[model samples]
Target: MQIASPLINELQCGERLNHAIEHGRRGEFALLLAMLSQDARDMAQFTLGEEGTVDAKLRRQFELPPAQTLVADVADDSLVNNGGEFHELGLRGFALQQALKPEALVTRGPISVTMLDALNNTDPLCKSRYLEPQHPALPEIPHFNDRLSGQLALAQRMAQA
Candidate 1:
């Protein structure tokens, strides 16, 4: 997790700015990815025992747009939190991601690097009756959590056409 290292540095104030930018130069989804990247940077500010503080930092990031990158770093920590059904979910997601686009587009700019989406997708609550019946996720147990529910209800109401 190279990201873990720089994240530590950013937190410690090695540079004036405490984060690296995941440059999302494309449209909306890319910007969302960029914001998530900035969120990752914001997350780095918490000290070791302050792990619990990440949620509030993320909440604040979700409230704003991504800033332009002064510099960027690529970190591959995809396997950091692997376990249980998550293992199966990771395999499936890796397969799907590969199948969708085996090669990333240089011209398309930064694509969103969603970490552990498979975990949310496989959540038992999401598989339960919480999601709307009409949701496309009804048939897919593993892809159900991203649909409208308590955590996503706000997103649902604010969804764009």
Candidate 2:
């Protein structure tokens, strides 16, 4: 699954924090100390999984109950406003945002192909360091070289007109 950059960064940060806690390295501990205030760490535990022995115990101590496991209940109107209405435009925009899973997009019915095409036409920003540009079909999308050439040609034509 393609994770977003922010999520990837958070995972990396979490791993670093875990490492720091495990090794008890003063420098890493100090860095985390400086970067995260107590309130920030509380928020992190709520959002990202809680890390660090002390932090986890502190979370329990503070009665900052573990975050709910189930997805939050969202209203249908909110879903529609958020582009979940299953229309072509909504699906296209949703695909652009990388919000819809491939299966979910496909199962939504007739607009699936168009949505998939639009998704194919777009490129996801590389998120994780482990991710490689290895998808075989990725090369078919208009690369920067072609896009630049098209823009220049359009500019030249406009200039003449």
Candidate 3:
């Protein structure tokens, strides 16, 4: 089965949270929160083992948002759009950063390959459960190199694997 990358999982989690808020579904909200928290922990661990510290540069590269703020914002109904929805779960900035950031190790091709590897190697079953099909607000997973040519490299790696 094709598995989603961590970045995709994070984006999906954010989308689900927004969907729950829009619909006032407490159960969905709880579920999304758990997924997000778990993913964050996984990303943090992966980052630490792969890199080392959460340096300002690395944080900036990862575009790790202030988790507290992101959660609080999602919890606030007032911040939700008229449809009680927030597109992209207000995570476009972070997503872009993550997609574009260079890997710790230098490479001849795109840097996203490392991130894609990190994401693909991550447990897909755990990531996919939270990405329920009913949640329509999820961000479209971009083509590997829509913005960054690095995605192409990542795609190649995935294909090979």
Estimated TM-score for each candidate: 0.14, 0.20, 0.21
Could you give candidate 1's per-residue lDDT for residues 34-86 as a string of tens digits?
A: 33323333464543464446656776768843332332223432222223333
lDDT of 3 by residue, 1-161 (tens): 44244333354565666777888999977765664534445553354454556665577798975332222223334332222122444466545544444222221322244554554555554435444453322344567567577777788899999
- Residue pairs clashing, model 3: none
- Candidate RMSDs in Å, in order, are 22.5, 15.5, 20.1
In order, the Cα lDDT scores of the candidates are 0.40, 0.49, 0.49
| TM-score, cand. 1 | 0.14
Cα lDDT of candidate 2 equals 0.49
Question: Candidate 3: which stretches are off by over 4 Å?
Answer: 1-9, 37-161
- In candidate 3 the C-alpha lDDT for residue 69 amounts to 21
